[model samples]
Target: MSLLFSEEEFQSAWTELDEPQLDGGWELFTESMGVKIYRLYDQDTGLYEYKVFGVLDSCPPELCADVYMDLDYRKQWDGYVKELHQDQFEGRPAVYWQVKYPFPLSNRDYVYVRERRDLDLDGRRIWVILAHSSPETPCAERSGVLRVRQYRQSVAMETDGARGAKVFMRYFDNPGGMIPAWLVNWAAKSGVPNFLTDMQKACSNYAAYCQRK
Candidate 1:
């Protein structure tokens, strides 16, 4: 939750966030767009990633949660989130990053990095396995992508992330990629929207709440 990216990474993301011009907020600016990019972590739900204006005005909490979960390509993007047990959980050094476009790609689902858990920011103890999703379709309104990022930490230097020396997976996805943005942007947009990123945030929050209860 604290600033995860380096100053350079933060500045680069800032440019990307501004290129789209979506009323990037100060809270969003400070968090290095990861806040919006990682909105689900804070809100415990999804919002239209491409919302031009504050279009989603408001909705019932249950309705928003329900809508958010279904729009993602990942199965039960929300339900998959249960709880993290403090006792059984261990830290991992690798981090995984996943991104999904509006449409499905042929021979998709192959974008996963090899031994991805090994990727981290400057040997940082945090291992973030982030996932994203987009329905296999042309881009349209409310057709924003969904993303989920899990921060994993290694429990100990001796554990080898718990799988001994064997390779372990850090990322997963439903399947597919999107058509060129020019095509999607050229066509009319449609549909209710959800974001995997927001869903994971919601899951994280719910899990924390459950842990407290």
Candidate 2:
């Protein structure tokens, strides 16, 4: 028992969330039942400003499951990013998960892998798996697994005669998840100044990246 509506209709339905604004930002506002919703707003270098949104079940295990599994998820289309601050994603691909079953229901499952083209490296990617089992039994949940696993990666980026490496690991397990407070606070922030240092190193070491050809 579900229904669909045009963007205007949907927007009209929730008059409260609406606000008069310019074209560079968007917001979410709602006080509803049975479902949750969010919105996005944007403006291109030379395009009209507009917005879009989504609605899902309250608990969202199903949504989370799908986002965490879909192996070829990145191929069909780069998933949409829900949070801009997390990924700093302006137009980056948003990888999502997909689930097969619920938690504490299955146990004979092996972990799986997915490639991370998102980083431009051909072999980097995050893996997916069940994080835990039901307390009552060692069985899996009917909701299956609500987790994703990503492999660690390291890259050597060079620019302006400097060489350095970028560690493609989560600030934690899955940087795609929540970043540690220090990342934004100061430690990671310091990396910005070192950009030229890496570039200079790479430029000075050009022969290292080449094979005498």
Candidate 3:
């Protein structure tokens, strides 16, 4: 079976998340919602990458994966997401996301190719989901909406003992505009924790909903 992302790319991302280099440009920023967040400067692009990690108690790895993969449930929890839809790009699964921005800033949207993989790492099961912006997708930029030209995000989840899931995420996006660097940094520091909290709650809710069905 063919894969959307090459094996090398997947393995590289997984390794990076599993054993991140804390000394090289990555700085611990804040801890909130039981998650530790880090910020790193991308010297090449002059942008910052946000790295987040935490463990959710009583949530299995599979449940965490299910919450992330389910797009319909995303709209229920992700407040910034204004629109989301599944699409295909070059015969690969892709998604279009229109996100709402704060006032005076235009909304941003992205078309990204998403892929999921389950792997065995040192006798432990890990699930990884990756998404990267794809300009090749034939999606027109909407009026009053800025197209995110550069964006990549990934999440890795693995079981912690018998009843917990450890989650790690790395995200970076260049919202092309004259927005001040300070504002972007502020959002990254303040917004990511809230996002993760909401995501954790959503996972819990989804698990309960599934149990009922």
TM-scores of all predicted structures: 0.24, 0.19, 0.89
Worst window of 10 by summed lDDT in candidate 1 = 150-159
| Predicted candidate 3 versus true structure: per-residue lDDT over 32-128, tens digit per residue | 7678988898876667998877787767888888888888778878889999989765565679999999898899999988888998977878888
**lDDT score, candidate 2:** 0.26
Colliding residue pairs in candidate 3: none
lDDT (CA) per prediction: 0.26, 0.26, 0.82
TM-score of 1: 0.24
Name the regions of candidate 1 deviating beyond 4 angstroms. Answer: 1-6, 14-107, 110-192, 196-205, 208-213
What are the RMSDs of all candidates, in order? 16.1, 19.8, 2.3
Those runs of model 2 whose alpha carbons end farther than 4 Å from true positions after fitting are 1-179, 211-213
N/CA/C clash count, model 2: 41
